[model samples]
Target chain A: MTPASPAEPTNPPLTRRARRRNQLVAVTGLVLVWVLLWGSFTWANLIGGLLVAVVLLTVFPLPPVTFAGRIRPVPLARFWSRFLRDLVVASVQIAWLALRFGHTPRSAIIAVPLRVNTDLNLTLTAEALSLVPGSLILEADRRTGTLYVHVLGVRTLDEVQRFRRDVLDLEARIVAAIGSSEERRRVTGADPAGPPEPTRLEGTPT
Target chain B: MTLDAVLDIVAAGCLIAGALLSLAAGVALIRFPDLLSRMHAAAKPQVLGLLLVLLGCALRLRTGVDITTLVLVGVFQLATAPVAAHMVGRVAYPHDEIRRDLLLTDELAAHIDRIRADRTDRPEVSDAASAPGRG
Candidate 1:
């Protein structure tokens, strides 16, 4: 029998203390990232990243804390391996393009379809993809499961086709690494090559 | 003078120019009475200003990796900012708070029928449809 779809809850509530704790964690994480990246205890960069994160959270609030659906913790070792591999691949691609194609290369904007759901997963996917040199996520239509991306140094239609396939593969690995166990079961069944199927989530078609 | 000193001077100059331009753009945002003008102010100098800042960063960094990262960031910002601004204007133009008196013509209103036909998902009252109504 097909598993019963998880029912959506409206306004998943968070305790006041939980909210404060989350904010603290977020701030701490930001400081750590800043120090790691800059290799110095620069208060300026730390504060700047914090402010940006705050603005982002204010503009886009988190999905309500729903009891029905659970987030899967990324397997740290696996996630690191895949992330590093992609980073290396992207850097090499960019370097190759710079050497061969000069600064301005023929580029196109294409939308690739994916199976991932949830704002957080989609966002993390986009950010990860964007760190790659030759490709950047322009926008993601979460409702449609499509990501608009700008790719550098494409010469022909065949290249575009390969690029599209590469994006799909990248997204699949990301989803596999980050998706909940239930999401893995649901998405693996859906054909990633085809048009997105309707989400089984209980929300009104958002 | 040492290479570091020379690099520092160039970086400082670029940083100063970038800061001034950004400051000008911020002032214009407050000073301008209309949305379009404010955007015009924002787009021109601020973008160039940001480029200068990136250049400054690249100059200051003695290592190749830092320079590469700064350049990549600059390129990404350049590519993304206009798209974001366009999207913002697309959403914001429909709002009543935008001053209509300052506009010459609202092209969105002229093409409202076509736009509505194109995007059935969006409300007819959205900024994309109301572009021409500002005049």
Candidate 2:
């Protein structure tokens, strides 16, 4: 028989206080959404939204996905700026590529090893990567913390390595911004003397 | 031009650009070779295009409620689109919908094979190992 591996719940169970807080946030969000959909903020809309929120929460609670990450201002600012820059740059590049139908750019599905292990980190990194125009996540094996990404416009091995580095850098920034202290330590400890360096693939040129 | 005129021009630009991006996504969907690549056409440009369209809506409506709603729609789209894409990708991979030739490194296939071998050696443990939830 396969040894019964320790069954770790995908999301840590929430405490009573945390549950209350989540409910409050959910209610407020629903009310705001209600007002927006109506294009007006009135007492009736607010009350209706609150009622709906309560009913929804009671009837169908969200799956127990833990929200454990905390925001670090400096790293978050850096991450946002980088993300926005990449957004614009990638959009333009993909748009241009698509319009130039004369030449078919080479594309490939490459595996990316992720150092960040938490569910939140994995989700955020995958989402961020997919949002960028040229790259999309083809498969995420949480079992191995590996992401298979389909990337456009990669014609050379150098470009592949560059893509890998970019992904690792993105993960590091995410770990810096919101990762738990242990995660932060692991990231920094990997490169003790200087900034966290991306793991280089063997045989890839420096 | 007056400030109102400027806002109108900017909003018009956003709307036009967003429409064009959506058009590109459609074209790519048709032209791309396989399921995996076709997904690239289906997802990326569509989200950005929706975002641009939302921005234009916010600019044109200029009311607090409308702007708030538009922003929320964009946020929810940003949060959900990738997840949907991921789910589709996951299903496609196992079903062999992917064109194997386009892959440079298929770590997933190797990983699955290794797990399968391990399971075959110890049949009793295979159920838990193959289950969808994390280990």
Candidate 3:
């Protein structure tokens, strides 16, 4: 479901070697999950997990493993630290909102258009945004790369715009951590990929 | 305190903090007006709460396999919670349960077909939805 040629017109297809590498990565990750689930590192668990991973891969036919970028350690570490902080903040904020007496929290449904319109970027950003406390993704437009976020406890237009900018900044951090140079450049406003165009289809009045 | 005592004390604190977060989620479930806001309560605080509980469990247990299992639970929660929330939110979005009144702005309304609120929809949401944001 990633950049089906026209979406990533400039991108090249993955070669056989690259495809193999992707499969290996997937299998390894699955195996790790399986082993972790079992809670032990026995031969049986290892073998069983491998068998399951292989079967699952064969059945599912791995989606485009189109990670054309390298992981930057510094940004990745920063991203993790920032993420944990956000997580704590989100939890505390939610807890406070829940406990505060007689205060009905105002919410909003703000649609944020992502700078990096790739499927992976959309998925990752949506995942991160939703996991954060105040924000939830109601709908994501894959074609135009927009996330309709349901935010809790916002009081004004400025806050809504601030949330939008925060979403973009989050996208920038994600791209910095794992996106390609081209993708990173796009987020930073260099060679604009330009999909924030709210180009929706036939949205009618309520 | 001795080292083990200190670890146990910290573990107890983690457990208490985690339980407090869970309590917050429970309070949120009752107090949050609409279905969507309740979903935020259901998903967000509980995740951190569960992770804290697991961390406490690991520190107290100090066993390899058990810690690994706890880690697995945390991983699964982190991975699946948002996805579950998204699916539920998508379904809830088109329904009358999502209080458009309490919503300061519905920018999503402009981009998609807004479902007209059926006056005789679910009573719980209708009552809560009518309850103006007292804040």
DockQ of the two-chain complex in candidate 3: 0.29
> In candidate 3, what are the lDDT values of residues A1-206, reduced to their tens digit?
12111233222456667667888999999999899888889999999999999999876665554677889999999988888888889989999998999899998887777766776788889888877758988887655566789999999767877887788888899999999998887778643444343323232322
| Candidate 3, superposed: residue stretches over 4 Å from native | A1-13, A190-206, B113-135
In order of appearance, the predictions have TM-scores of: 0.43, 0.78, 0.85
Model 2 accuracy (lDDT, Cα): 0.70
Chain B superposition TM-score per model:
0.78, 0.80, 0.80
Worst 10 residues of 2 chain A by lDDT: A1-10
Cand 2, B chain, TM? 0.80
lDDT of 1 by residue, A1-206 (tens): 11112312122245566556666666676555555456555678788778877776566544333222344455545665776565445444443433442233444445555555555556656655564434555445534445555554566656766776776666656656656566566556655545432222222111
| Top candidate by lDDT | 3
Best prediction by TM-score: 3
Fnat of all models, as shown: 0.00, 0.33, 0.64
Top DockQ model: 2
